[model samples]
Target: MKIVAVFNYLLSFLIAYWNTESVAEDEFIYGQFPSYFRWGIGTSSYQVEGAWNLDGKGENIWDNFTHSTPSPIKDGSTGDFACDSYHKYEEDSKLVKSIGVDFYRFSISWSRILPLGTKEKVNQAGIDYYNNLINSLIHHEITPVISIHHWDLPMPLQNKGGWTNEEMIEHFGDFARILYANFGDRVKQWFTFNEAWVICVMGYGDGIFAPGVKEITETPYTCIHTILKAHAQAYRIYDLEFRDEQQGQVGITIDSGWLEPSDPNKLEDIEASERALQFKFGMFASPIVFGKYPDIVRKSVDERSKQEGRSTSRLPSFDKYWTDYIKGSYDFIGLNHYSSYLVTSASSDPGPGWYGDQNAVTFQDPSWPETGSTWLRPVPWGFRKVLNWIKNTFNNPPLIVTENGYSDLPDVGLNDYGRIEYYKGYINNLLKAVIIDGCNVRGYSAWSLMDNFEWASGYTERFGLHWVNFTDPSRERIPKESVKYLRKVFLSNGFPKPTLPWNSIQLNEQCAAVALDPDTSF
Candidate 1:
């Protein structure tokens, strides 16, 4: 019943927003996908490059965590040799070009760029590897969308108390500047950090990921402050320093799933859902987009801190410069969305519950389909709802989806029908937003270009449109059935036939043709 209502609400919202005639033509009709539009697929350094301690690369939190604590990962496996894209990137770039994307979005490993987490000494190899990747992408006519940080923090920085320490803001900004000076000319789209919620909350709040620290009340809040501060500082540096020369745009990507209160009319449940909103979405969005923490966040955390007898809200404060620094930081908004959750306030008091989800909120929906990656559930309507929420909340800044894809269990085959289904549904919802809702959403990047490390879940969950053979030294990439379909969507500028059960389209031949000559996607 709850799921039905949420779907009904989303469908009606689409109906109000949609106008099929305007976007009914080919996908390319949107003006070379807007001069700002980017069709990209991404891979993070730690997740794909897999050269933890080689050629002067410094240690990072992931390096230490994966090596120091094995069992914390699902299969007790590390990313020591995952994908090995560092050595075989030429081949990988060839694959990316084959897919006919306009851009390649990959993160620079912080430890690789600044081994000591400082500019005192630059790692030549680290710079060279990325330079090669960037040059290769450009050589093949693919633009580069670079992320300055993506979960991999230099171990030295972590040892110095990481995000908990105030100094991190300036240090991270300096690092961003260095990249700005070096590659900003070629890489027009720069992302300061991937998603802070996963970094601070999941990693700090729950200790499930790297830099693993389980300090919910204190740590997560403090970490949020540092991440935002760092992002703001980075954005300011890039905006001031490189914007004129490189003429690029910068923004931080945030993760937010749609929330449906078990009962929207019920105040407590609604408030609980909103709190979850302020927690999951607001955790990062409030600071970046709104320039301050949400009211619910500050109040709730303040009261909690008072109960704990803390000096003040664990959430840090910035001086006037920072207040100004953090405001208007984004050139555009980058969002990674998947699934939706049903939020019902937990039992009132005096009961045990899920760690992060204590009397907090419960996420369940009988209608949503689960993924091999247990953290995800298929909820297509949620994508449109969340995108709309972002537009309304941020007054509709230009939006781009940095990451979105389905994950499957290891046993899933190369020809994944479920993956195809997931893409069609979410993308159809996305088209609904662009056509009906008139969202300024300009670009989309598949979650991953290749199968790489999946953090704590290890290699158990696969989200790549192209499968990576872990045992193969070459890490051979095989295009999944979904990849072809996605290319067609990209080629079409997301125009769709007015229909339901939209996952039965075919595109294997197109995939083969596109892969044959990646440089000329058209």
Candidate 2:
């Protein structure tokens, strides 16, 4: 037995060394992406369009959240004058065109179109503003990908319980009809909602985002249920009413971190890692793909509710009609992935919240490359793994990476090498997933064209390829090193062949070593 164990150890060491050496000496050469593969950059309305309450636009949850007396924003700043994109959209479109991208992804603020969050009144000026933006992108030969709702719920709707109330399904459906009727002619790609997990869990459960409400036990689940139905409603409307004429595709964008087991050899840790993904990604994806929540999620939430002495589960049950309505309601899946986490089985019950229900604990690895955002670490391998997970889970549905970027502190000047390296590693892995692993990924969009309001964190974190001088009244835009890198990748459609092999292999080695180390606790 001892001789066999020695042989296994030596063999594993040799394999690891061989892999590391091959990666170190390999040249960064990858085949061109598919001819139809798209590259783009994105920004949200509230983040870029700063005309808060201007030109008939109504107050949104974000406006209320940031303008509160005791501001929830880390920098005590609001999006009142974000990037002034509402007025300077032409210039923004020019910036996007200069990047040599195929498309530009932006969101529509519900409050901007419907001042009261209903069809009873429509803001013509708001409609004209978006019309000009869309026209500008088209004039520059850039396709427009629009997200209908990006967490900027109209305040009037929040007063009526926002996403937690079932009425939101109809309200959102009505809103979608207005959008399709007005803008569907030009916008070919539509996302019904951006990051449903963040909208429901962070906004309602953790109370850290807009419309902050901390009813941890039930509010999050209720909000998620309503959002899913609302998404389905919008998709059905587009499919039934506008598909033939508009020729548009509608979907939802979900943001989730890849969860890696702390100890691959431990069954509990492995199970906990998968449970975390099912709770996070599967919670939203499964309903649209498989017509129901993951069995583990259903069972765990039901069991927890019972243990908490509740007669019913906090998770709302979908009826047969609604289940069928939501099933296969999408033309594609938009994923907004940024980082990853290491998950382990919790030692004790975490109480009656979402985290407690999963019976799992997640944390970041200190050895991983860090970024300006504490929650985000550049883990490129995680991106590949998550892509594979989605392909396997959903039977390889058409996938688009709606948002992926690296954040930096405000002081990281124009020569930002870190951001360049970050993109290089992530995009290289992205190519590997598509070319080598055969994941059905069709497109990718960088997070922001320029830094704007970053929600609760405000302007403290910058995730833009172009630097926006927030202090200047004009908000001067200057391209960074990362911009040139992305432009090259966009122009070539993939990494170009190098004249010499690259030797800096720390990031790849760290990811591989950590993944293979069974005893290394995350």
Candidate 3:
């Protein structure tokens, strides 16, 4: 077994090396993106804004989480001073303007605005801060795309059961109304929620995130149920009350990874791959697009509950009213895609949890290039495939790539050749999806504008085009090599004729070495 593995590894490396050399020599000419297509970069409130509790801002789940004894953050770091964007909006706006992007996508801190997550006690300071930011972006000719919630639930609300409680739908709706009334005039693109799955599954099921609760059977499902309802409520609020006047679009951003079958020839593997996607992406998307959960999700959870001797299904069911209300609630779909996974059918029941319910096991292929983030791999082709899947599944709803970018280790410095290649491959694939595949992708936003607090991982993972000096009080931002590469891509609107050789030598060497190591985890 060892001898065969070594030989296979060597053969794979040689093949990859030959392909890399050939591609570097070939003249690569890419087609132009649509002139109407927009470009932007993104950052969330908790990840970028450092003033966790200041100037009438209340505590959020993240503030509480990081402040807890023996913090769960990998580096024992908190976002209390994360990039200090709260105090440096002017500087940040200048950075965004320098990027030459058409827009900037950012999330409003729920507690910052409402202070207590309610509309009753509005935070004037918070309102002023965002107003200034918006006015600054507009001053710089940059549109502001706002996400109402980005997983930073006010601690006051989390104490009241957060997303697991049905009352959150009303609270979230009220929050949306306040935002629309205040910022909707200037903010034309509003995302009600960012990455509902991560907010629910990772936060509630795995307990690896803030407001942690690890009850997999019902907690995660209940949270997502509330989230979908809250999203719909926010969408409806904007549609009925503010749409005519504000002239803004409302959407929800859902993060999904492309899943491929481990064995193309095996029916079970293919079925498992589809089931995994349905469980992961469709769990949130289906509610808004198809008016209910995916058929497989419903059936699987129903069957699993029965096996557990429960009289009722663990998965929450939406009645006719919700089915109709949630359907067609979005003006567009906000998609955040990063990586791909190979999935196969679990040989046996994997027990009672989210992964168990799907009956699928997902893993990464050794040949795929890795990133500093353990779960992410550079699989550009998967981007196109996932876009096509969305196009087919949702009947080609107008879509925006909300969050897609590469991450590197903290010490990788500013050169960052890997990130440049990543953008090159992924953006090229994105072009193919829009041009050749005919997917209705409207715009794209890189995951971040600068390095800041990365949730549970703290500052260990850097996913920014601009390197931020975390140690400095000012958090000075320096552009990485990828920034220059992306600026050229943005200025040209697409990849122009390659005047220089494609820089794949380093990436090829790294991936080839990774492929040879059988024990590599990520």
- lDDT, candidates in the order shown: 0.76, 0.86, 0.86
Task: Please give the range of 10 consecutive residues that has the lowest summed lDDT in model 3.
Answer: 513-522
RMSD of each: 6.2, 7.3, 8.1
Error in Å for residue 104 of model 2: 0.5
Clashes of each: 5, 0, 0
1-522, model 2: which lDDT tens digit per residue? 546534543443343333333332223435668888999999999998898989999999999999998999999999999999998999999999998899999999999999999999999999999999999999999999999999999999999999989999999999999989999899989999999889888999999998999878889999999999999999999998999999989999998888887886666776787789889999999999999998778989998899889999999999999999999999999999998899899999878878889999999999988789999999887787788777766788999999998898547877777777777677877787787667789999998899899999999999988889898989888988777667877887876443334355864554443222322221
The C-alpha TM-scores of every prediction are 0.87, 0.91, 0.90
Model 1 CA deviation exceeding 4 Å by range: 1-37, 349-359, 496-522
lDDT score for candidate 1 against the true structure:
0.76
True-vs-predicted CA distance for residue 215, candidate 2, Å: 1.1
Model 1 CA lDDT for position 179: 88
Model 3, 477-505: lDDT tens digits are 99887777677677678764333344777
- Kindly indicate the candidate among 1 and 2 with the higher TM-score: 2
Which parts of model 2 have CA positions greater than 4 angstroms off? 1-29, 498-522
